[model samples]
Target: MVRSGAGESMRQPVRREERDRGEAAGGGNRSGGLVGWRPRVLEHKVRPADLRAVGEVRRELRQLLSRWREPAGEDLTEIATLLTSELVTNALVHAKGGALVRATVTDRLRVEVRDFAARRPEPRAATADGTSGRGLMLVCSLADAWGVRSHAVGKSVWFELGGGPA
Candidate 1:
Protein backbone atom coordinates (compact mmCIF):
# COMPACT_ATOMS: atom_id res chain seq x y z
CA MET A 1 0.00 0.00 0.00
CA VAL A 2 1.30 3.41 -0.97
CA ARG A 3 0.51 6.33 1.28
CA SER A 4 0.28 9.85 -0.07
CA GLY A 5 2.56 12.54 1.26
CA ALA A 6 -0.29 13.61 3.53
CA GLY A 7 -0.24 10.10 5.11
CA GLU A 8 -3.52 8.93 3.61
CA SER A 9 -3.73 5.71 1.65
CA MET A 10 -3.37 6.56 -2.00
CA ARG A 11 -5.02 3.32 -2.92
CA GLN A 12 -6.91 1.08 -0.53
CA PRO A 13 -5.50 -2.43 -0.42
CA VAL A 14 -8.74 -3.74 1.02
CA ARG A 15 -10.64 -2.68 -2.07
CA ARG A 16 -7.89 -4.11 -4.24
CA GLU A 17 -7.89 -7.32 -2.22
CA GLU A 18 -11.65 -7.63 -2.60
CA ARG A 19 -11.33 -7.09 -6.30
CA ASP A 20 -8.55 -9.68 -6.44
CA ARG A 21 -10.69 -12.19 -4.61
CA GLY A 22 -13.61 -11.48 -6.94
CA GLU A 23 -11.32 -11.84 -9.93
CA ALA A 24 -9.83 -15.08 -8.58
CA ALA A 25 -13.35 -16.40 -8.23
CA GLY A 26 -14.10 -15.35 -11.84
CA GLY A 27 -10.63 -16.03 -13.40
CA GLY A 28 -9.19 -12.58 -14.19
CA ASN A 29 -6.55 -10.11 -13.09
CA ARG A 30 -7.67 -7.33 -10.78
CA SER A 31 -4.52 -5.26 -10.52
CA GLY A 32 -5.83 -2.28 -12.39
CA GLY A 33 -7.29 0.82 -10.73
CA LEU A 34 -11.01 1.48 -10.39
CA VAL A 35 -12.59 0.23 -13.56
CA GLY A 36 -15.11 2.87 -14.46
CA TRP A 37 -15.83 6.35 -13.28
CA ARG A 38 -16.37 9.91 -14.37
CA PRO A 39 -14.60 13.07 -13.39
CA ARG A 40 -16.06 14.94 -10.43
CA VAL A 41 -18.17 18.00 -10.97
CA LEU A 42 -17.35 21.41 -9.54
CA GLU A 43 -19.93 24.15 -9.31
CA HIS A 44 -20.28 27.71 -8.09
CA LYS A 45 -23.28 30.02 -7.74
CA VAL A 46 -23.21 33.76 -7.29
CA ARG A 47 -25.54 36.74 -7.32
CA PRO A 48 -24.81 39.04 -10.22
CA ALA A 49 -25.98 42.31 -8.70
CA ASP A 50 -22.91 42.64 -6.49
CA LEU A 51 -19.99 43.48 -8.74
CA ARG A 52 -17.35 42.95 -6.10
CA ALA A 53 -18.89 39.67 -5.10
CA VAL A 54 -18.88 38.61 -8.73
CA GLY A 55 -15.22 39.54 -9.09
CA GLU A 56 -14.33 37.58 -6.00
CA VAL A 57 -16.23 34.63 -7.36
CA ARG A 58 -14.28 34.86 -10.56
CA ARG A 59 -11.02 35.02 -8.65
CA GLU A 60 -11.94 31.97 -6.62
CA LEU A 61 -12.82 30.13 -9.80
CA ARG A 62 -9.45 30.98 -11.30
CA GLN A 63 -7.63 29.76 -8.23
CA LEU A 64 -9.57 26.51 -8.17
CA LEU A 65 -9.09 25.70 -11.85
CA SER A 66 -5.47 26.75 -11.70
CA ARG A 67 -4.81 24.16 -9.02
CA TRP A 68 -6.46 21.43 -11.10
CA ARG A 69 -4.78 21.97 -14.45
CA GLU A 70 -2.37 24.36 -16.04
CA PRO A 71 -4.28 26.86 -18.13
CA ALA A 72 -4.45 25.62 -21.70
CA GLY A 73 -2.34 27.41 -24.29
CA GLU A 74 -5.42 29.43 -25.11
CA ASP A 75 -6.22 32.25 -22.73
CA LEU A 76 -9.03 30.26 -21.13
CA THR A 77 -8.74 31.88 -17.73
CA GLU A 78 -8.83 35.35 -19.25
CA ILE A 79 -11.64 34.39 -21.59
CA ALA A 80 -13.66 32.85 -18.80
CA THR A 81 -13.03 35.81 -16.54
CA LEU A 82 -14.04 38.25 -19.27
CA LEU A 83 -17.04 36.18 -20.23
CA THR A 84 -18.22 36.01 -16.61
CA SER A 85 -17.66 39.72 -16.12
CA GLU A 86 -19.50 40.65 -19.30
CA LEU A 87 -22.47 38.38 -18.70
CA VAL A 88 -22.79 39.41 -15.07
CA THR A 89 -22.32 43.05 -16.01
CA ASN A 90 -25.06 42.78 -18.58
CA ALA A 91 -27.33 41.10 -16.09
CA LEU A 92 -26.78 43.81 -13.53
CA VAL A 93 -27.09 46.64 -16.01
CA HIS A 94 -30.13 45.45 -17.92
CA ALA A 95 -32.08 42.93 -15.86
CA LYS A 96 -34.97 43.68 -13.51
CA GLY A 97 -33.85 41.53 -10.59
CA GLY A 98 -30.50 40.10 -9.56
CA ALA A 99 -28.94 37.36 -11.65
CA LEU A 100 -27.62 33.88 -10.95
CA VAL A 101 -24.16 32.89 -12.08
CA ARG A 102 -23.49 29.17 -12.38
CA ALA A 103 -20.16 27.68 -13.39
CA THR A 104 -19.47 24.01 -13.95
CA VAL A 105 -16.40 22.15 -15.09
CA THR A 106 -16.67 18.65 -16.45
CA ASP A 107 -15.44 17.51 -19.86
CA ARG A 108 -15.37 21.24 -20.43
CA LEU A 109 -15.91 24.44 -18.54
CA ARG A 110 -19.29 26.13 -18.87
CA VAL A 111 -20.41 29.42 -17.40
CA GLU A 112 -24.01 30.55 -17.34
CA VAL A 113 -25.30 33.90 -16.21
CA ARG A 114 -29.05 33.95 -15.76
CA ASP A 115 -31.16 37.01 -15.20
CA PHE A 116 -34.81 38.03 -15.24
CA ALA A 117 -34.62 39.96 -18.44
CA ALA A 118 -36.39 39.09 -21.66
CA ARG A 119 -34.47 41.62 -23.66
CA ARG A 120 -32.01 40.05 -26.04
CA PRO A 121 -28.52 41.46 -26.01
CA GLU A 122 -27.87 43.30 -29.21
CA PRO A 123 -24.60 42.92 -31.06
CA ARG A 124 -23.22 46.41 -31.22
CA ALA A 125 -20.89 47.69 -33.89
CA ALA A 126 -17.88 49.48 -32.47
CA THR A 127 -18.29 53.16 -33.24
CA ALA A 128 -15.48 55.59 -33.86
CA ASP A 129 -16.70 57.55 -30.85
CA GLY A 130 -16.20 54.47 -28.61
CA THR A 131 -18.42 54.99 -25.59
CA SER A 132 -20.88 52.15 -25.08
CA GLY A 133 -22.19 48.70 -26.18
CA ARG A 134 -19.42 46.19 -26.76
CA GLY A 135 -19.76 43.62 -24.04
CA LEU A 136 -21.43 40.97 -26.16
CA MET A 137 -18.87 41.53 -28.87
CA LEU A 138 -16.08 40.90 -26.40
CA VAL A 139 -17.87 37.78 -25.24
CA CYS A 140 -18.22 36.60 -28.82
CA SER A 141 -14.55 37.22 -29.49
CA LEU A 142 -13.43 35.33 -26.41
CA ALA A 143 -15.78 32.37 -26.19
CA ASP A 144 -15.81 29.36 -28.50
CA ALA A 145 -19.59 29.72 -28.67
CA TRP A 146 -22.06 31.77 -26.69
CA GLY A 147 -25.74 32.63 -26.86
CA VAL A 148 -28.78 33.49 -24.78
CA ARG A 149 -31.39 30.95 -23.71
CA SER A 150 -34.78 31.89 -22.41
CA HIS A 151 -36.19 30.50 -19.19
CA ALA A 152 -39.63 30.82 -17.60
CA VAL A 153 -38.38 33.60 -15.39
CA GLY A 154 -35.82 35.31 -17.62
CA LYS A 155 -32.80 34.23 -19.66
CA SER A 156 -29.40 32.66 -19.32
CA VAL A 157 -26.32 33.76 -21.22
CA TRP A 158 -23.94 30.86 -21.52
CA PHE A 159 -20.46 30.25 -22.91
CA GLU A 160 -18.16 27.26 -23.32
CA LEU A 161 -14.44 26.73 -23.66
CA GLY A 162 -12.93 24.76 -26.53
CA GLY A 163 -10.52 22.60 -24.57
CA GLY A 164 -11.14 19.35 -22.69
CA PRO A 165 -12.74 19.34 -19.24
CA ALA A 166 -11.04 21.56 -16.72
Candidate 2:
Protein backbone atom coordinates (compact mmCIF):
# COMPACT_ATOMS: atom_id res chain seq x y z
CA MET A 1 0.00 0.00 0.00
CA VAL A 2 1.15 3.56 -0.61
CA ARG A 3 2.29 5.44 2.44
CA SER A 4 0.36 8.65 2.95
CA GLY A 5 2.75 10.12 5.44
CA ALA A 6 5.70 12.50 5.62
CA GLY A 7 6.35 15.52 3.37
CA GLU A 8 2.99 17.00 4.29
CA SER A 9 2.76 20.38 5.86
CA MET A 10 0.35 23.26 6.20
CA ARG A 11 1.88 26.40 4.82
CA GLN A 12 0.29 29.73 5.44
CA PRO A 13 -0.55 31.81 2.43
CA VAL A 14 1.93 34.53 1.54
CA ARG A 15 0.75 37.88 2.84
CA ARG A 16 0.40 40.77 0.44
CA GLU A 17 3.09 42.79 2.14
CA GLU A 18 5.47 39.85 2.11
CA ARG A 19 4.71 39.24 -1.49
CA ASP A 20 5.32 42.88 -2.31
CA ARG A 21 8.60 42.76 -0.50
CA GLY A 22 9.58 39.55 -2.23
CA GLU A 23 8.66 41.01 -5.57
CA ALA A 24 10.58 44.15 -4.81
CA ALA A 25 13.59 42.07 -4.06
CA GLY A 26 13.05 39.98 -7.21
CA GLY A 27 11.30 37.14 -5.36
CA GLY A 28 14.39 36.37 -3.34
CA ASN A 29 15.57 37.17 0.14
CA ARG A 30 16.65 40.78 0.63
CA SER A 31 20.10 39.72 1.78
CA GLY A 32 20.01 36.80 -0.70
CA GLY A 33 19.51 34.29 2.10
CA LEU A 34 16.79 31.77 2.84
CA VAL A 35 15.78 33.13 6.23
CA GLY A 36 12.14 34.30 6.10
CA TRP A 37 12.12 33.74 2.34
CA ARG A 38 9.16 32.05 0.74
CA PRO A 39 9.75 29.23 -1.66
CA ARG A 40 8.89 29.54 -5.34
CA VAL A 41 6.48 27.04 -6.81
CA LEU A 42 5.77 25.83 -10.33
CA GLU A 43 2.96 23.48 -11.25
CA HIS A 44 1.76 21.71 -14.42
CA LYS A 45 -0.77 19.05 -15.30
CA VAL A 46 -0.30 16.54 -18.11
CA ARG A 47 -3.17 14.90 -19.95
CA PRO A 48 -3.50 11.12 -19.59
CA ALA A 49 -1.30 8.96 -21.81
CA ASP A 50 0.22 12.01 -23.39
CA LEU A 51 3.79 10.78 -23.18
CA ARG A 52 4.99 13.53 -25.48
CA ALA A 53 3.89 16.08 -22.94
CA VAL A 54 6.65 14.87 -20.66
CA GLY A 55 9.18 16.65 -22.80
CA GLU A 56 7.16 19.83 -22.59
CA VAL A 57 6.98 19.51 -18.84
CA ARG A 58 10.72 19.07 -18.62
CA ARG A 59 11.22 22.14 -20.76
CA GLU A 60 8.93 24.15 -18.55
CA LEU A 61 10.81 23.00 -15.46
CA ARG A 62 14.12 23.95 -17.00
CA GLN A 63 12.69 27.36 -17.78
CA LEU A 64 11.51 27.81 -14.24
CA LEU A 65 14.91 26.82 -12.87
CA SER A 66 16.58 29.24 -15.20
CA ARG A 67 14.38 32.10 -14.05
CA TRP A 68 15.15 31.60 -10.39
CA ARG A 69 17.45 34.17 -8.83
CA GLU A 70 19.74 31.36 -7.72
CA PRO A 71 19.19 28.42 -10.04
CA ALA A 72 19.93 24.97 -8.59
CA GLY A 73 23.10 24.71 -10.69
CA GLU A 74 23.51 22.56 -13.79
CA ASP A 75 24.06 19.24 -11.98
CA LEU A 76 21.09 19.67 -9.67
CA THR A 77 18.90 20.96 -12.48
CA GLU A 78 19.77 17.99 -14.65
CA ILE A 79 19.15 15.56 -11.82
CA ALA A 80 15.83 17.24 -11.09
CA THR A 81 14.83 17.01 -14.74
CA LEU A 82 15.74 13.33 -14.96
CA LEU A 83 13.97 12.36 -11.76
CA THR A 84 10.89 14.35 -12.73
CA SER A 85 10.88 12.66 -16.11
CA GLU A 86 10.94 9.29 -14.41
CA LEU A 87 8.00 10.06 -12.11
CA VAL A 88 5.93 11.64 -14.85
CA THR A 89 6.66 8.87 -17.31
CA ASN A 90 5.70 6.26 -14.78
CA ALA A 91 2.47 8.05 -13.93
CA LEU A 92 1.48 8.37 -17.57
CA VAL A 93 2.40 4.81 -18.50
CA HIS A 94 1.21 2.95 -15.42
CA ALA A 95 -1.55 5.13 -14.01
CA LYS A 96 -5.06 5.58 -15.40
CA GLY A 97 -5.11 9.36 -15.67
CA GLY A 98 -3.05 12.46 -16.17
CA ALA A 99 -0.43 13.54 -13.67
CA LEU A 100 -0.03 16.79 -11.84
CA VAL A 101 3.56 17.93 -11.42
CA ARG A 102 4.39 20.40 -8.69
CA ALA A 103 7.88 21.78 -8.04
CA THR A 104 8.86 23.91 -5.08
CA VAL A 105 12.20 25.64 -4.75
CA THR A 106 13.89 27.28 -1.80
CA ASP A 107 17.28 26.22 -0.52
CA ARG A 108 16.20 22.89 -1.91
CA LEU A 109 13.95 21.54 -4.65
CA ARG A 110 11.04 19.16 -4.25
CA VAL A 111 9.17 17.66 -7.18
CA GLU A 112 5.94 15.70 -6.93
CA VAL A 113 4.02 13.78 -9.59
CA ARG A 114 0.46 13.10 -8.60
CA ASP A 115 -1.67 10.58 -10.47
CA PHE A 116 -5.13 9.04 -10.20
CA ALA A 117 -3.88 5.54 -9.48
CA ALA A 118 -3.96 4.14 -5.97
CA ARG A 119 -1.13 1.73 -6.71
CA ARG A 120 2.31 2.44 -5.39
CA PRO A 121 5.42 1.81 -7.45
CA GLU A 122 7.96 -0.81 -6.56
CA PRO A 123 11.53 -0.84 -7.71
CA ARG A 124 12.64 -3.95 -9.49
CA ALA A 125 16.15 -5.07 -10.23
CA ALA A 126 16.90 -4.20 -13.81
CA THR A 127 18.55 -6.89 -15.90
CA ALA A 128 21.65 -6.03 -17.78
CA ASP A 129 19.95 -6.69 -21.07
CA GLY A 130 16.54 -5.36 -20.08
CA THR A 131 15.60 -1.99 -21.42
CA SER A 132 13.06 -1.08 -18.74
CA GLY A 133 12.40 -0.86 -14.97
CA ARG A 134 15.05 1.49 -13.63
CA GLY A 135 13.20 4.69 -12.91
CA LEU A 136 12.39 4.11 -9.27
CA MET A 137 15.86 2.80 -8.69
CA LEU A 138 17.33 6.01 -10.01
CA VAL A 139 14.99 8.04 -7.82
CA CYS A 140 15.93 6.06 -4.75
CA SER A 141 19.60 6.40 -5.44
CA LEU A 142 19.70 10.04 -6.41
CA ALA A 143 17.10 11.98 -4.47
CA ASP A 144 18.10 13.34 -1.09
CA ALA A 145 14.65 12.27 -0.01
CA TRP A 146 11.76 10.45 -1.74
CA GLY A 147 8.38 9.03 -0.79
CA VAL A 148 4.78 8.44 -1.76
CA ARG A 149 1.78 10.35 -0.49
CA SER A 150 -1.74 9.17 -1.16
CA HIS A 151 -4.41 11.66 -2.02
CA ALA A 152 -8.16 11.23 -1.69
CA VAL A 153 -8.30 10.24 -5.34
CA GLY A 154 -4.85 8.88 -6.08
CA LYS A 155 -1.26 9.39 -4.94
CA SER A 156 1.83 11.42 -5.45
CA VAL A 157 5.41 10.17 -5.93
CA TRP A 158 7.84 12.80 -4.83
CA PHE A 159 11.56 13.38 -4.54
CA GLU A 160 13.74 16.17 -3.25
CA LEU A 161 17.21 17.50 -4.03
CA GLY A 162 19.06 19.98 -1.87
CA GLY A 163 20.56 23.03 -3.60
CA GLY A 164 18.91 26.27 -4.60
CA PRO A 165 18.83 29.94 -3.59
CA ALA A 166 21.69 29.75 -1.17
lDDT of 2: 0.83
Summarize candidate 1's per-residue lDDT along 55-80 as a digit string, tens digits: 77678667656744335443777778
lDDT of 2 at 45: 88
lDDT of candidate 1 at residue 61, scale 0 to 100: 62
- Per-residue lDDT tens digits for candidate 2, residues 1-166, read 3344595666666643356477777764543565666667889989999999899989988987886667668988899899999999999999978999999776567789999999989899999999779999999989987888888989999887875212
lDDT against the true structure, each candidate? 0.68, 0.83
Worst 10 contiguous positions by lDDT, candidate 2 = 11-20
For residue 161, give model 2's deviation from the true position in Å.
0.5
> Highest lDDT: which candidate?
2
**Model 1: how large is the Cα RMSD against the reference?**
15.4
Runs in model 1 lying further than 4 Å from the true structure: 1-48, 69-74, 164-166
Clashes per candidate, residues 3 or more apart or on different chains: 1, 0
